[model samples]
Target: MSPEEKPGGPPPPPPQAGRCRGARPQQQQQQPRRGGLLSEIRTAIRSEPFHLRYRLSPGRELGRGKFAVVKKCIQKDTEKEFAAKFMRKRRKGQDCRMEIIHEIAVLELAQCNPWVINLHEVYETATEMILVLEYAAGGEIFDQCVAEREEAFKEKDVKRLMKQILEGVSFLHRNNVVHLDLKPQNILLTSKSPLGDIKIVDFGLSRIMKSSEELREIMGTPEYVAPEILSYDPISTATDMWSIGVLAYVMLTGISPFLGDDKQETFLNISQMNVSYSGEDFDLISESAVDFIKTLLVKKPEDRATAEECLQHPWLEQSDEPISRAWNESAGGESSDVTQQDADSASEKSVDAEKTEEDESIVTEELIVVASYTLGQCRQSEKEKATEQKAISKRFKFEEPLLQEIPGEFIY
Candidate 1:
C-alpha cells in the first residue's frame, strides 16, 4: 500500500527509490515519498490562492498521502522539470488552509540549507492544492541499506551521510524547527551530479519551537524516536540527535540497534536506552564512531551531543579513509572489482532482495521480527487513537508511510 492508500496519514515508506525505475510490478508500484517533505510542501502550497502557474504533466507518482500525491511535473513554457505535489484543500469537514501555510513556512525557513528540499511554486483551487518543487532524482537511500552487500555502508559513507545530515539539521535547529521525524524514508538522495548526497525532508511531524518552550508530542517512529517522546515528556533538539544515532547505526551496520520483537519490547529497549555495538557488527566499526553513536544514544537528551558538537567529533571531522577494505568487501564495498571475489550466490547489491518482501522495505531478515512488531504497534496505536479521540490529530500522523515506524521505511 502507498502512503496515500493508508488511512492514518501518509506513511514515509520510501519506495525502491533509486532513479525511479520505469517498470514496476503491480504489487511493487508504491514509489518513494519524494518522502513526506514533498507532500508537506504540497499541503502547504494550498494555503494561498495563486494564478495557474504551470501545466502539470504528471509522471510517476513520487509520494502518496491521505490527501496528497506528488508527481514529476514539467513547466509548460520552459519545459523544466519539477515535482508537482497535489493536495486536497479540505478534509474530514475541516478547512485546512492553515495547514498549507504551516508547511510553506517551514519549507521557506529551511530553504537556506542545500540539503533541504526546495519549494518551487504554488497553485490552488477550491478543492485542491498544487506545489511545484525541486525534484530529487536519486530517491531514498533505503534500497542500498537493505541490499545484500556484505556491508550496508562503509564508515566513510556513513560519515558522508551523517555530516550532511548534521549540517542540514543543525541549520534547522538554529532556525528552531524540530524535525520530530528523522529516518531514511524522510531522507532522500539527490540525483546524478551529487549522486548520493542527503536531503533532510518531511516536515509533517516537524515543529518550530520557541527557544523557551518544551516541545512535547507523541510523534516519530518507534525505533528512531527519542526516549523522551516515549514518556510523553518535553522534547528538545536532542530528539533529532537521537534519531541520528539510530540512523548512523543502521547505515553502518544495516541493522537497528534498539528494535525488538514487539512494540512493548521496542519501547522497552528505547526506555532503557539499551544498544549494542559489541556484536560482530561493531567488530569492524571504529571505536570513535561507536563512541559518537553512544554519545547521541544516551538515555538523557541532555546527555546527547548537540549537532554542532557532533560535527566536531573526530569521526566526522577527520579523515574518513573508509572502514578497512576487508570490512567493505565483506559488507559490499564501492569497488565493483572487489565484489567479484564474493561467491556467485552473493552478488554485490545495493539492497539484499532476500530480506525485503517485494516493495516492502524492511532491510534484513534480522529486522523483520522487530520491524513487523513496530508495524503492528503503529497500526494498533492508530486504531486506538482513531477510536479514542473525537478527532485524530495529524501531529502523530506519519508524513509518509506505507507501514508505520520508519513508514516508517522499516525504521522511522
Candidate 2:
C-alpha cells in the first residue's frame, strides 16, 4: 500500500513525472492510520517536536547520532516503508533548534533537485521540530567503500554515479550554494540498485555565495578542504570541486588521496599535497579519473578546475580504454607533472594544522547530528493543531483597550 492511501488523505497527485520517474514502486490501496506504531509516532511528534519515539519492532537500529536516530519505519496508512529519523533536542548547551532550522532552510532551498534529498514537511512542538522526509534506504556511499574493503568501485559505476553527483553539484552551484561539507557519508542512495542513484544530504555547513569571487569562510572537512580555504584565502564553487576530486579519488581507489591515522597527520599530508597510488590500484583506475582528481586538488584554488569545467575534462570526454591506459602508463605518481609553480606552492602550504585547530569554525568531532522526523508525526500534528485552533477561536475573547482619544488633559 502507498503511504498516501494509508494516511487516509486524498489520493496523492502523481509525482511530477520528471521528479519521480519510477523511483518508488506502486502498491495496493492502503487503509488509513489506525492505532499502531505509526500512530504513536504521530502523537509524539504532535506533543513535542523534539525527542523522536518509534517502534521499529523487528527491524534493527541502523545507526544513532547525538541528535537523531535512524530506524526502519513502515507506513501503516499505505503499507509503504521508510527509514524514520528521530531527531531530538541537542544536548545541554547545544543549539539544536537553530541547527535544524539551518538544515531545513538549506534543504528547502534545494528541494526541487533530484540529486538532493527531498524534505516532505516540518512541524514543531515545544520540545521538538518534526521533519517528515522522503527516506533514502539504500544508505550512504561511505558504506560502499567500507564494504569494498580494499577494492575501489568499478570505474564504470564510478562514472555513472559521478555524472549524477556532478549534476547535483552543478544544480547547487547554479543556485550560488556551496556545500562546504562534501564527503562520502553525506551522499545517500535512494535504492541499492545497480545504477546507484544518489541524493546529497546534510546542509549544516552549506554557504550561499553572493558573487564569483572566493569566499573567506573557514569551513569543510579536513580531508577535503581546499588549501586556500585553510589560508583564509577565499572559497567559491571551486572549493566544492576540490572536495569532489577527493570524492572521485575515493570512488576509484577506495582510499582517500590524502589520509592519516590522526587529524594532524591528515592535515600534514594535505598541506604538503602528499598523495600516493599503488601500481595495482592505479592500474584499475583510468587516466581520466586520475587527471580529473589531479586538476582539482591543485594547491592554487584558482588553478583548480571548477565543477563545470570538470564536466568537460578530457578524461570525462574519453573512452574507457584510452582513459585506463593514461593512469597505467602516463600520469606521474606522488610527483605530478603539473608545473614548477604548482609544485613550489604545494611545497610551501604552511603545514600548520595547529593554527587551523584554533580557528572558530573547526569542530573536532567524528559527526554532528541534528533534527530528524517521521511522516506520521507531521501529519498527526497538523490535524491536532487545526482542531485546537478551532476550539480556541470559539471560546476565547479579547477585551479591547479603553479609548483614550481625549487630548492630553491639561486641566480636564
Candidate 3:
C-alpha cells in the first residue's frame, strides 16, 4: 500500500503534467521517507521569509482581540492568502516582548500539530509583531453554534470537534505548552461549515513549562477557569483539561455551566467545582458523553483525564464496535501523548461489573447550578466593582459580536 493510503492520512497530490512517468507502473518504486518531516520543518525555519515578501491587502480587518488585529494578506508573487496577526509591542506602559516571545515559542513548538494553527513566518515593525498564519476562513466555533440557531450542536458534530481538540491539546502537552485559556471562542474552524476542520487559536494566554514546573497566576475567563486556578494552586496540563470539560458542556448544552450574573458568583461556582450534566437536555446524550466530560472536570488536577485518555473514551470514537469501560492500564497509560491517532490502543481488559458504579456518576438534562456554592453577597462595594468592570466590557474586540455565527461565505 502507498504511504498516502495509510488510514486517516491525507491523499497525495496528483501527478504533474510533463513529468516523467518513469518505468512501467509495476516497476515504479515507492518514495522513501527519511528523517521524518522535522528536518524539512527545520530547513523551512532557517529560510523563513520576511515582511517584504507579502503584499498587505487594503486594510481589510479579519478579526481583532484585546491588543492585536488579524488581517488578510497575499503573497507578492504567488498571491497565496494568509492571515497576518499583528500584535502591539507595548501594553499598559509595559514592554510586551516577553509575553509575545513566549507565545511565538509555544506556537513554534506546536507547529507540527495539524489541528493547531500553522505559523508560516514571523516579522516585526517598530511597534508590532506580525505572524503569518494559515488563514482559517471559519470563525470561532462559539459563533458556529449560534448560527445553527438551535442553541446546541448535535452529538456527531461534537464528536468530530472533541477528537480534534483532544489531539491538539495532547500535542501541546507533549511539547510542554499549556494553553491556559481554552474556550469555544478560542476554537476556530477552517471554514464556515460543520465539516470545516478544527483550528485552535489565540495562544496569547498560553505558556510553555517544564513538567516539574507550575504557574500560579490567576488567568483565563471566569466562566471556564479551572477550580485550581480559582484557588490559586499550581497550574499544570490538567488545568487545561478543566477548561476542556467546560467547553464540552457549553457545546453540548448551549449554556455556560458556570457563568453567573456577576464575577463573584462565577468564581464561587468554579471554586466549588459546581458542575452537573443533569436535566432533560442530557436525556438524549449517550452515557459515554457524560463519562468523557466528568472525567475531565475533576476537582483534583491529577485525577482529571489526560488528553490521551479522553481520546480513548467511547464518545469521541463514535464507533459501532462494542464499547468497553474496562481499560488496559499498562498499555493505555503509556504513550507519546502527541496526537489521538498515536495515543489510541484497543483495550483487552474485560469490564469488571464491580466497577460499573464508578461510571454512573451523573447524566441528566437540567444541569443544576450548585446552590451550596459559598460566596455570599458582594463583599466589596457595588460601585467599586462596577468601576473595575467598566473596561472589561471592551476586552474582546471582535469584528462582529462574538456569538453571532452567520455562516455565509466569508468574503475575504
Per-candidate TM vs. native? 0.68, 0.62, 0.65
lDDT of 3 by residue, 37-66 (tens): 111112122233455688777865776655
Native-to-model Cα distance after best TM-score fit, residue 312 in candidate 1, in Å: 0.2
lDDT computed for candidate 1 = 0.60
In model 2, where do residues sit more than 4 Å from their true spots?
A: 1-58, 89-92, 149-152, 212-217, 319-412
Query: How do the candidates rank by lDDT, highest first?
Result: 1, 3, 2
Q: Rate the local accuracy (lDDT) of all candidates.
A: 0.60, 0.53, 0.58
RMSD value for candidate 1: 14.7
Residue-wise lDDT of candidate 2 within 1-412, one digit each (tens)? 1222122234232222112333443232212121100111111124533224333437655445445555565545565555555555554545456555545555654555778877664557655565556677777776554332222246766777787787778766765567767777677887675545888876655655654344476656667777776677777778888889888886665455665544566668778888765444566466567887888888887788876677777866665543332222334422122223344455467455634543332222111111111010000111123354332221111111111110000000
- List RMSD in Å for every model shown: 14.7, 21.5, 17.4
For model 3 the local lDDT of residue 305 reads 94
* Residue pairs that clash (backbone atoms under 3 angstroms), model 2: 1-78, 2-78, 6-77, 6-78, 49-128, 49-129, 50-128, 215-235, 287-323
lDDT of 1 by residue, 1-412 (tens): 2222222333222222111234332233321122223222222333444424455564556666566677776676788877776767676666765555556556655554677787776777778767677877766665445544432456787788888898778767765567877876667777533447887766656665554556556777777788998898888889999999988877776566676655566789889867777654566778898899988998888889998889889988788675642345445433333433443334345356642432242112111212212221111111223243322221112223223222221211
